[model samples]
Target: MAENQWSTAITSVKPNEIRVRGYRLDELMGRVSFGEAVYLILRGERPGAAVGRLVEAMLVASIDHGVTPPSTLAVRNAASTGASLNACIASGALAVNRHHGGAVEDCMRLLARGAARVAAGADLAAAARALIGEEKTAGRRLPGFGHRIHTDDPRSYRLLVLAREAGTAAAHVGVAEAIVAELAAGGKALPLNVDGAIAAVLADLGFDPELANGFFILARTAGWMAQVIEERRREKPMRRIDQGAAVYDGPASRELTQG
Candidate 1:
């Protein structure tokens, strides 16, 4: 190896071949779902069949929360300024900071702390109550409970079901459920939102907390691109972007048909 040369184990490039985590890129193209490929590239191992589905569900759950989300708004605003696609996407990515698209990582850390308490022989509910009390005493809100919109996030329920079916519901998931139950029992009733569910599922699936928000960024990139395209095609340049004044005129309720 050359002096001071950097190296990465993520991918290898040769004259006419490319490999990711030791799998041939061309061969992996059609054989694996994007979620499975993502798992392989990130974790350096192929996911079990059900794990891929759960991962895909997690991606879908955060694909697009609408124009109100900061990321999407950033994308749209950048697009309206006649920015290039990459630049607009970069703008959106930058908006995914601590308060916006970061709940997954934050919640994963919270769940990990609770899971560690449980591992040390603390009762799950008791641990949860203690954690909640600590957070309350600190005047800090729980990262993944409650939402500005839905009382019960449908995506959260679906993701958790998929996680259990995928066999990835373990300690972190149990801790999350315990926290929710504890909150409810205390008359607070803060439901576990989608971020909390993803955090638990990802933690149980052996993902590091650092990569939690990356899942959201990957999924939401698709929506950002769509928003960017729409902004370029429909709106005048340099116009103000207002989330509150936006209305959905694209489609009404619809059903998907299976072939």
Candidate 2:
């Protein structure tokens, strides 16, 4: 085989035929919902109707968190520089890293580990308590359990309720609930955030935890484009290149001396 040769089973295009994960594009058009299509492309199979609905809810929850997010700010700043729309959106996506939009994946890994412990014969609540204790011992802040702005994340609560109604709540949801209960027993009242709820749902849906952040990025692209267009329309070019109120917190200004 050629060293540079690459093969993929994801998609194939040849002579007016396009297939995604074994499904003909023509057949899927106007048939599968966007969320199902996303699942098909990523997971190699389309999700069931209920799972598709849950996927759509996750996308909606991640779409935007106001214009104050770093991703949105990056997009608007790039738009101010007269960059192309694609560039602006790319900038925004690039800004979503471990600190900004990474909790979904993090929480998914935690949930998976806890579920495995339960499957190995440990009591569900006991496993959850042990996990929390381990995290606390390591001085690691638990992700997806708290929010800076919301005392109780309405999105998280709604997603859980919907999951119950959809009959899709499974071991992952139970483990997540157990973790919450353990936290409350410790007198730390941290409500689950949207990322945490999405993490649990994705686990129940059998998605790879590694893809959680990517899903978030895919959903947020729509919001980034909207912000880019709005910034281009309402703001002046290069308007924020320099903020007049910036302060120098370093050493006093010094003059260069001739050698």
Candidate 3:
């Protein structure tokens, strides 16, 4: 294949002309909110008011958790090392994976599966219960259920409320609620976290699961930039982090031995 043969339906560009999802880029600049633009670019259509709110809310929800989040730490650390803003932000984004700031994709997949099961006639409650049980039995924690800090994530609650008010709450939301109920029934009060809530809401809004993590990266980029800027302004260059606070339970330092 020739290089010019590589094509994209997302955008069309020529001299003095730019189009995205069939709209002139200049037309979209002031008329559409960033959230609406994001939806239009990714989903190929402008969102209804509710979807706009939902997308905006999703972006706002994960903007920052604090300095302790891996992404923030990465940004701060790189900034302390005198990295450029772009490099610091890139380092921050690179820290997002399954363990930190990455539950959205996993939660989206889970919610999608639950929604499908419900569409296939399984009761929401039953499906949720069974799925949660299977995950627990497999020693896997539900991606959007628990948080290390908040007992209840305020952002999750607000997003759900907005989704309901926007008339966008549907099967995936039901599945998420049912999962919460199932966890409650099992005496594990794992409330839905923001990642899970966003997954359900976005699923209801018809997003493909593959876009879930990308959405997170997009949203959190703002936070990374902010944190990087703050670190550069407030912290000394290459500040030494004390490792003494970490507990050492490993084997004692030993001399080399012949096998």
Which candidate leads the pack in lDDT?
A: 1
Off by over 4 Å in 1: none
Q: Kindly report which residue stretches of model 3 are placed more than 4 angstroms away from their true locations once superposed.
A: 1-4, 240-259
lDDT of 1 by residue, 1-259 (tens): 8899998999999999999999999999999998899899989999998999999898999899989988899899899889999999999999987677788999999889999999999988988988898889998889888987788889999999998898789888998999999999988998898888999999999899999999989999999999999899889999988899998998777778631
Query: What TM-score would every model get versus the actual structure?
Result: 0.94, 0.85, 0.89
Top model number, TM-score: 1
Name the lDDT value of residue 98 in candidate 2.
60
TM-score of 2: 0.85
Worst 10 residues of 1 by lDDT: 250-259
How much RMSD separates candidate 3 from the native structure? 11.3
lDDT of 2 by residue, 111-185 (tens): 888889989988879888988988899988777788777878898888898788778888788888888888888
Residue 121 local lDDT, model 3: 95
Against the unseen true structure, what C-alpha lDDT does each candidate score?
0.90, 0.84, 0.86
Better of 1 and 3 by lDDT: 1
Steric clash pairs (candidate 2): none
lDDT of 3 by residue, 25-55 (tens): 9998988888899999998989987788789
Q: For each candidate, how many residue pairs have backbone atoms clashing (under 3 Å)? A: 0, 0, 0
Error of 2 at 72 (Å): 1.4
